[model samples]
Target: MSDSSINLDELRQRIDQLDGDILRLISERAACAQKVAHVKLAHDKDAVFYRPEREAQVLRRIMSLNEGPLDSEEMARLFREIMSACLALEQPIKVAYLGPEGTFTQQAALKHFGESAISLPMAAIDEVFREVEAGAVNYGVVPVENSTEGVVNHTLDTFMDSSIHICGEVVLRIHHHLLISDTTRRDKISRIYSHPQSFGQCRKWLDAHYPHAERVPVSSNAEAAKLVKTEWHSAAIAGDMAAKLYGLERVADKIEDRPDNSTRFLIIGSHQVPMAGEDKTSIVVAMRNQPGALHDLLEPFHRHKIDLTRIETRPSRTGVWNYVFFIDFKGHVDEPRVAAVLDEVRLRASELRVLGSYPQGVL
Candidate 1:
């Protein structure tokens, strides 16, 4: 046999052996998870099997211990699926995301929970929150902010009234593509359809290229992609998921004006997550109308040397004179310094609510 043929045969044999080892190890892990479920049931029938803090720790440890040709994130993502499958064996869970099945929110949900999870599509952001609150789903994923377009006000507003906690977070890098189905006429494209947020994200590109095309704002990019599938003279601006779902060709890829346009999504659940080394806490503070109310609310954070990631102001719904400030910081609420800061802020504000402290997005 040729030396090259011998090398190829040896390499394929090694890979097959490795695959067999991986399969056995994964089966052992799933069996252990099933035993854990039985133990929890014996201890308490209502015990929650899905623990976000534990999942975060496992992923972080995998990333830290990885010494591979594959990058850290890529390696972590592979383990994510394994953990997801094991968790399903422990107890299968359902997650809800903003709808039509092809949106970026759905991608985020799948990214966080893995493919083994049952992900349902909700019609709106509020509905995602409602499903979680109503116990119809185990968790919900909703967009909180975008790098290009800023915060999602509807999502922020929904948090103001809901009792649900942010158990985790997932950040998805967005790439908008100009899509056309087989029926679409590339030369005669006259109308462009997309969600208003997507249109805003791709405003510069649209203005420069399709200046004359009638722009229609639909409920979602997925819906727009669906619409263009049946129209011969129309095109849609959406992501790869939508294109793949609707079987559309990408005429223009990465049409977003910014190369790094991304959105941060929050995982909403009923339980508060325990500390997982790296964490972020979100809170809403309602302040009475006064000259130094804002300053007073922020001073505690500055004094405690807590790193504030983001702060957004929303008009209070209860009273015109009151202003609500949504604050995100880089520590868990259980920490001493974070607790001190919250106490001081509570004394200074009319009302305070700690949304949740969850592990920072690892994968």
Candidate 2:
């Protein structure tokens, strides 16, 4: 064999040896973690199997120990699975997402839960919260904000009365596409259907191309895709997944106003999530409509060096146009700095509700 070929073979052999060693080490580590779970349970008299603190420590240690030819982010993600598996050795997780399946919420659900979860799809945002509240699901995924348009009002409003806490979050890139039935006639298109959100995301593209086509709003992107199947003259604006799931052909893709348009989703559950060094908290504060009310509510956060990630105004629902500002910020609610900010804000606002504190969503 050529010298270079012989060298390649030797490298492959080494990689195979390393892979086996890594697997063996992971299995041993899992056994050790399970033992830790038992010890924690005995001491705490609660479920010690899922220690968010230990999970965070494991991930941080993995990053610290990594001398990676692989990216640190990639290494951490792989280790997240290891911790997830170890945790599951103690308990398997059940997650809920907003969907009829093929919805963006499902994408966020997968991102948050990894592959080791039982994911249930719900028909409405409130239904997702209901499932979590009812203990029918362990975690619920729902949209909270969109970069292009604004907050998902339904999700924010659900927060108004719901008692379920936000446990984690995920952000998903929103992509819009124009899809049609296989038999659709390109020249005879009359009306288009999509969820209002999807239509809003693709508004500029639609106006410039199909200025005369009637735009109709449906309950969801999937429903719009389903509508197109019954009528050959109508096309649906949805994501690639919807098109694929409905067996529709895409005539247009990436049609959103901007390429970076994305939505932030929240994972809601009953438990208060432990601090994962990098975390975020969401709170809803209702202030009496006074001049500089927002400033007064935000002042404490600024003083505490808490970073505000999002702020959206919604009708207070107690009265029309008496708006409440929904604010999301960095740092877990359990942290001292964040707790202080909330305490101060609570004193200033008429009403203060902690939506939840959770780990910041990663792409």
Candidate 3:
């Protein structure tokens, strides 16, 4: 045999052996998870199948221990799926996301919960919050902010009236593609469909290229992708999942004006999550309408030297709400420094509500 042929044969043999070994290990892990399920069932009839803090710790450890040809994030994703399957052996988790199916929120849901999870799509952000609040689903995922477009106000506004807690977070890097169905007239495209935020992110690009095209804002990129499937003169701006789900072709890829466009999605549930070492706490403070109200609200955080990730102000929904500040900061609520800051803020604010402290996004 030729030298190259011999090397190829050996490599194939080695890969086959490794595949078998991996299969065995995965089966063993699933078996162990099943054993865990039985033990929990014996102790508590309503044992939660998933633990946000525990999952975060595992993913972080996987990334930390990785010294691989595969990137840390990539390796962590593989383990994510593995864990998801094992968790299904314990119990399948039902999650709701804002969507008509095939939206970026759905992608974030799948990424965080894995394919083994049962993900349901809701029409709006409030619906996602409502689902978890009603106990219709075990958890919900909703977009909180986009790197290119700032905060999602609707999500923040929902927190003011809802009791659902933030249990975890997931960040999805967005890459918008101009997609068209097989029957779409590429040359006759006069209208482009996409979510408003997707259009906003790609404004410069749109103006430079298809400036004359009518930009129509829809409920979601998935809905946009769905609409174009029957329209001959329209193209949809959406992501890869939508494109595949609807059998569309990419007319242009990664057309977002910002290359690093990403959206942060929060996991909402009925229960508060314990600290996962690295954590973030979200709170809404209704400030008294007075001088230095803004400054007074932030002073405690600065004094404690706590890292603030984001701060957004929304018009209060209640009669008492003149201005409500939504704050996200580093450190779990259980920590002394965070507790001290909250105590100070509580004294200054008319009202305060801790949304939930959750593990920081790991993958």
Candidate 4:
């Protein structure tokens, strides 16, 4: 045999041996996870099988320890799947996300929780909250904000009325594509369908290419993709998940105006997550409708040097011209400095509710 062929054969044999070792180790890990479930169940009948903080820590550690041809994130993602599978052996988790099965929120849910999770789709953001609030699902995922389109006000408004807590968060980079079905007449495409935000993201691209095409706003990009499947003269602007789900072909890929377009999704649940070293806390503050109310609200955070990640204002339902502020900042509430800041802010604001203090996104 040639030297190159012999080398390739030896490499293949080494890989096969490594695969066997990996399989055995994974089995051992699964057995250990099963034992953990038994121990927890033995002590507490209703013990929670999933720990967001713990999972976050593991993924973060895996990323930190990785030194290979594969990047840290890619390595962490592999570990995340392994952890998810082992957790399923302990107890399967149910998650709800805003969807008709193929939206970005669904993608975010799958990214945050692995494929082992049972994911349900809700028609509206409020419905996602309701599912988690009613205990129908273990957790819910909802889009909080987009890098280009700003905040998802519907999600913020739903949070105002719901008692659900934020468990964790995941950020997904969005890439909208112009998609068509097999029957679509490429040249005869007279209408385009997409969510309003998607149209905004891809406005420049559409204007430059298909300016004459009627831009039809729909409930979601998934719905747009679904509509295109039946329309011969229509195309949809949506993400890869929607296109794949509807079996549509991409006519134009990554047509979003900005290359850095992304969306942040929140994982909502009943339980408060413990600190995972690096953490972020979300709170909603209702200030008295008076001069310097906003100043009073933000002074504590600034004074404490707490890094604020996001701050958004929504009209309050209580009174005229009243506004509630949704604030996200670094540090867990269990810490002395963070607790001090919250205490000070509570004294100044009319109402302050800490939504959650969870580990920042690991992947």
Question: Each candidate: RMSD to true structure?
Answer: 1.0, 2.9, 1.3, 0.8
TM-score of 2: 0.87
TM-score for each prediction? 0.98, 0.87, 0.97, 0.99
Better of 2 and 4 by TM-score: 4
The C-alpha stretches of model 3 lying farther than 4 A from their native spots are 319-321
| Candidate order (TM-score) | 4, 1, 3, 2
Alpha-carbon runs more than 4 Å astray in model 2: 29-68, 185-189, 229-231
Better of 1 and 2 by TM-score: 1
TM-score of model 4 (CA atoms): 0.99
C-alpha local distance difference test of each model: 0.93, 0.83, 0.94, 0.94
Q: Clash number for model 2?
A: 0
For model 1, residues 182-204, the per-residue Cα lDDT tens digits are 98889999999999989999999
Candidate 1 vs candidate 3: the lDDT winner is 3
- Residue 124 accuracy (lDDT) in model 4: 91
> lDDT for model 3, on a 0 to 1 scale?
0.94
Error of 1 at 119 (Å): 0.8
lDDT of 3 by residue, 1-363 (tens): 999999999999999999999999999999999999999999999998799999999999999999999999999999999999999989999999999999999999999999999999999999988889888999999999999998998999888888889999999999999999999999999999999999999999999989999999999999999999999999999999999999999999999998999999999999988889999999989988999999999988888899999889899876665889899999999998899999999999999999999999998
Measured by C-alpha RMSD in angstroms, how accurate is candidate 3?
1.3
Give the lDDT ranking, best first. Answer: 3, 4, 1, 2
